[model samples]
Target: MLVESLAVLTLALLVEAAIGYPGRVYTAIGHPVTWIGALIATLDRDLNRDDASPAVRRAMGVLALVAILAVPGALALALQAILSGFGLLGLLAAAILASSLLAQRSLHEHVAAVRDGLRAEGLAGGRRAVSMIVGRNPESLDEAGVSRAAIESLAENFSDGIVAPAFWMGLGGLPGGVLYKAANTADSMIGHRTPRHDAFGWAAARFDDMINLPASRLGAFLLIVAAALHPWASARAAWAAVRRDAGRHRSPNAGWPEAAMAGALGLRLAGPRTYGETIVNDAWMGDGRAAATAQDVDRALALYRTACALLIGLAALVAITALALSR
Candidate 1:
């Protein structure tokens, strides 16, 4: 069962990289994340009450997390069981469904758009493109700020949007992936330090951090290996930065990839940044250039692509080994 799950994960990664989630399909039925996000919104509206005590809200948040995971988890389990009975055809169907959980192609496109915006439309264009991917205030960003924001988003989402989901699916199959996505979606929606969400989102935020721990480290290793392969990137520096700086970022998981990418590409990332009117004074990653350019965005994309390729290779190797051992 574990071997089959790994195989399905490998296929899902390949399929997502090849075609992505098509716009037409999304327009017609919406994407899986959107579907999950809708449920999260409903839960937040229904369960999270403003007048409730923090302790009560925290407990409600835990309940909400379980409810959020159960619906998709059960559906994925049923689908996986039914498909397993169909053998190869069912495997293909499962892979296609699992592919929706990854964001390889979409992440590339969105980050590339920032570079394009910087090139064609200057700071305004860069800001516009970057605003789509990052939570930071776009208007506050200069050209370098926009570039850094895009690269940071790219690195962080590389872990969250790809590695983490793929890691879970490889371990526990379709239901695992669905459940991880559900928890991650909930975290993003409510896991802020705001007065309303501080207690209510506690469980989602903590669980997300715990589940992401392994994938975060694995993702950093992948980026370091990718840096070794690229003439322009530095594997040693990447490793050094991760060792020196990963734990400094606000998020325990986000720091690993961000540090690796920053070190590999020889750029400083994730210093002080604004989200709305709030400025987060965070530690910088990598002892390199702070004035990141559109060109640096391109460099980060190259490194990202190499890291993604490495992830695919790793998945294939695991699937093969798992199958052989099972046999």
Candidate 2:
């Protein structure tokens, strides 16, 4: 199982990098997170009642979160067990299933679309492209605003989408990745502080925080290492920014990579921004220029690519080491 797990980690990352989650596969079965989101939505609608007390809602949230986490792991483990008997075919199947949890290719594509849009159509296009990846209000963004938003989303999601799942998969195989994706999906869908969700989503939000703690740090480390390889990036600056600014972010986990990216690329990120009509007066992540442009986004993408390559290389090394030890 150790060898199999390592093989799945290597193959899944490569497969995802090569093709992403195919549109046809998504069209046929929908995405795994979406499927998990549906279940969370059902629980939210059914159990999260207005009449329920705060204690009741919080307890219900925990129940829902537990079920969400358990179901996916059980299914994946059962599938893995059944497939293991098939040898190589089982490994391939596990890899395919695991690949669905990663977003390395999709993340790059989405960020690249923002760069392309800004280059081709200016502010409107950039805003439109950035809107797809962020919850912030797009209409208020100038060109710099759009670029920063796109880059910020890229950095933050790079942690959640790539590092977190990969970290879990490396340690716990397919079921670990599945469990992580489920927790992440739950956190996204219900983990909010609005009047409707604050009490009910407490468990999901806190649990997500706990799970993401280690990977978030690792994500920053990877970005710093990647920055060292790129002429335009600064590993020293990335580490400095992480120390200075990661704590400034609202999320317990997101600021690490975002700050590292900001410092590495020498661009200020996560300043004041609008979400719908509300303006969040957030502290800036890096002390660099606040006036980002499409070119900055492109540069960020280049840095992201290098970081991703570094991550894959690290995973391959780990897989190779595990294989050697297993012998």
By TM-score, who's the top model here? 1
Measured against the true structure, the TM-scores of the candidates, in listed sequence, are 0.99, 0.98
| Residue-wise C-alpha lDDT for candidate 2, range 158-277, written one tens digit per residue | 999999999899888898899999999998989988777898899999999999999899999999998998888899999999999999998889899999999998989998889998
Q: By how many angstroms RMSD does model 1 differ from the true structure? A: 0.7
- Clashing residue pairs in all predictions, respectively, total 0, 0
Q: With candidate 1 superimposed using the best TM-score fit, by how many Å does residue 300's alpha carbon deviate from the native?
A: 0.7
Which residue runs of candidate 2 sit more than 4 Å off their true CA positions?
none
Q: Which stretches of candidate 1 lie over 4 Å from their true place?
A: none
**lDDT score of residue 104 within candidate 1:** 97
| For every candidate, C-alpha RMSD to the true structure in Å | 0.7, 1.0
Question: Which residue window of length 10 is worst by lDDT in model 1?
Answer: 318-327
Relative to the true structure, candidate 1 reaches a TM of 0.99
